[model samples]
Target: MTVTTSPLLAVRALTVRYGAAQALRDVTFDLAPNSALAVLGPNGAGKSTLARALSGLVPPVAGSFALDGRDLTGQSPDTIRRAGLVHLPEGRGVFPTLTVMENLRMATACDRRGRAAAVDRAFEIFPVLRERQRQAAGTLSGGEQQMLSLARALMVDPRLVIADELSLGLAPRMVDVVFESLRRARAAGVAVIMIEQFASRALDFADRCLVLQRGRIAWSGDADRAGPELLRRYLGEATAA
Candidate 1:
């Protein structure tokens, strides 16, 4: 069945496990179309696992996922991506040996309008990419690679972009640049689900926040309502102790 509502993505009673270790337990949430949600948690909070489950990279042990009301629980990654649910995994997985242009081309290959238009769109977002078109992806700086990874995902014209740790290991200014680009994507009507370690910065770009603790939702509310005290509580002594 398909869901016809404001939510573009919905997960119900989701569970993920690695052997006997449960990474996510009864996780659930809704991402409204064109909105941004920041999934916040400390290390081992199951944030990445949840992102993977939603993106069809890791199969859920239980529960259901729907995109625009269409059930997507068991779909392959490619299939889910084709349906406009794109996942940009953590670590910015660009083909290091390939040139910037080649990486963009590889990503655009899956686009319906084909590579040409997708390349154009990618360059429009990060003009620096055009300048480094011939540079091997491995040679690009960490920030540049992050831009390329995001551009690659945008090439698919996804309605929902699931970004896992887009700001990992980047300088502060570069983090601003990446998040700014994400704001642009959201302005263009793309819903975004971001996993971020920096709570304040994540709140800057997110309308709502979900804090995961030990594979379950510890808190969920408007970003404005999620203050330091709440964050400290959810994060526990690991962050505040």
Candidate 2:
């Protein structure tokens, strides 16, 4: 006998458009609880558009999405976020002008109870943020800023985190740091959808992979099956693994 668990997140026939141009057409996938999926494609493949649509930043022209059996199609971003679906966009989503401590504090604004504990937990995850808590976020190094950005997930207690371009422009060492942060989130039973241009490491980290081409799913399968050959075939030289 086999037992089957429902997917933590489900996207079915998701289509998006900008005016008459279709950005995504019938994109579909499923993610189990606490698992990770990587979205890989060349430039203009609608990777970020998929992230935006899932997080309610872009309204989909057709199809539906659900988290934990709750339909989230066409809901507002805030509504989706509060429902434990968090989108960490490409820019890290940190308030540049605010101090590191101030930014973490901002993440706790929704709930008044035990806010200090939330900040402390964030500090525990990224002690570098603690050491430079008083420093302005804009002045921090790219890696440090990304640390501050990921801390919001801890403060808000997310179930499914959509991280787009997490390792965009940083030193190689910093890329390791960013990936470790993602590991910690998955360890805490949070699902992750990583939309990455740099494919090698992300492909290794994810349990599954979804490939998009011209806004449609070109390939979808286990991450181990997504290699240089597939990348070269679909992405050309744009995202060579």
Candidate 3:
């Protein structure tokens, strides 16, 4: 498998706050190209906050994030995105009224010359998207909409893909499809940061794991070494058996 030992992105002493309430505190980690890092934690563990801070959607009050030694701590979302970092946010961040093709075109709008080719690349990943190219995205089922969202992100050809809840509400088969796409992205040398609530699935697919509890990293290490018992210890006893 393609992998890199050097860090592609690094976060240190990261912190985020909403008004007076701190959402994340002193979070730190590193991600490498051609690898998948799973961020696992229960709700309110700051998983989503971490994702938003990385994407520049939410401002971090402390610490820093750097990509290839470039400080991205306070960059605008547009600037961060253009710098080869893409965030596939939860709830399928797609334009509901836009057609499948149109939704994809929006992602490549910054580079109109590459729109056609980008759309073609998207279709290659999810052929159903090609069939529904003319249909409104809102009309598509949950799984198809999620596929469209993933396909659109690929339009940017990002170096790092942060997927927040990639398989939230999909059926087993659809979840498999989304994960397969993620694997393809990883194999293609794209660094992936998966923020998922499904601990078992995330731990199984990721190369490394970071477990969060109360907005702090409870554990961090190789996923292969984090056996079921170890994960359950930090994630609570309710984790899958």
Candidate 4:
């Protein structure tokens, strides 16, 4: 008999409350290595809150989280990142004053290996960053900045990457570029948990999906099996022709 390795990351009965309002209630999920898990939900459905908790940006009110069997329930964001879990936040937090190359270098500096190798990997995924190496990150278009955010995260060589609203505020073509980059990340053995508002596109790239509603998981299943009804229930909208 063969025993499967435990999941790359696990959330057991995780709950987070902001002040008096509960943002998540006993939420649970696991991400296997090299797999992509998409979190789908309508606005105010606790998707962002959940991503925050997973990335150690916000504390959990109850329950536990672990990465590779190591406890991370109350760890700081820096500590979690040092442990190979990286979060590319919703706002594409690139340094405005720094050049694109500078932003990538900053992230690569933190890697265990010398910065040279990490820089190479980042450039390989985003050659455009190399082309625009001297441009200030703030000057780049929305899509370019988003790419920089992802490239920065990859510089860390993370085992798990949590991306919040990866497709937010971009042209459809740019969204495709971002998703393609994410696919490459997944191919390279990184587990990705993405919180996305675009259900159709998220499902396109995700192998498994979890739908959150009112701070709870409404549905969790294979993306292929998750159809219009599941999306409707999560989004609270009827399907359109």
Over 1-241, each residue of candidate 4 has an lDDT whose tens digit, in order, gives: 9989789888999999999999999998888888889898777989889888988989998999899989999899999998889988888779989999889888866554678888888889888888999999999988889889988887887999888987788888888888888887887778899887677778878889998889999899998888887677667663200
**Model number with the top lDDT:** 2
lDDT of 3 at 203: 78
lDDT of 2: 0.90
Writing each residue's lDDT as its tens digit, candidate 3 over 1-241 gives 9964768898999999999888889999998767889998877988999999999999999999998678999999998988888999889889999998789988988899988888888887678889999999999988788878878877898889899998888888878888888877776678889987677888788999998888899889998888888877877767533
Tell me the deviation in Å of residue 136 in model 2: 0.9
Question: How high is the CA lDDT of each candidate model?
Answer: 0.88, 0.90, 0.86, 0.86
Alpha carbon lDDT at 25, candidate 1: 97
Per-residue alpha-carbon lDDT of candidate 2 for residues 1-241, written as tens digits (9 for 90 to 100): 9999999999999999999999999999999999999998888999999999999999999999999999999999999999999999998688889999889888888886968989888888788898999999999988888888998776788899998998889899888888998888888778999998788788899999999999999999999998788889998976775
TM-score of each: 0.93, 0.97, 0.93, 0.94
Candidate 2's TM-score reads 0.97
TM-score of 4: 0.94
Of 1 and 4, the candidate ahead on TM-score is 4
Error of 2 at 208 (Å): 0.2
lDDT, candidate 3, at 89: 89
For residue 218, model 3's alpha carbon misses the true position, in angstroms, by 0.7
**Superposed model 4: Cα runs more than 4 Å off:** 1-3, 111-113, 238-241
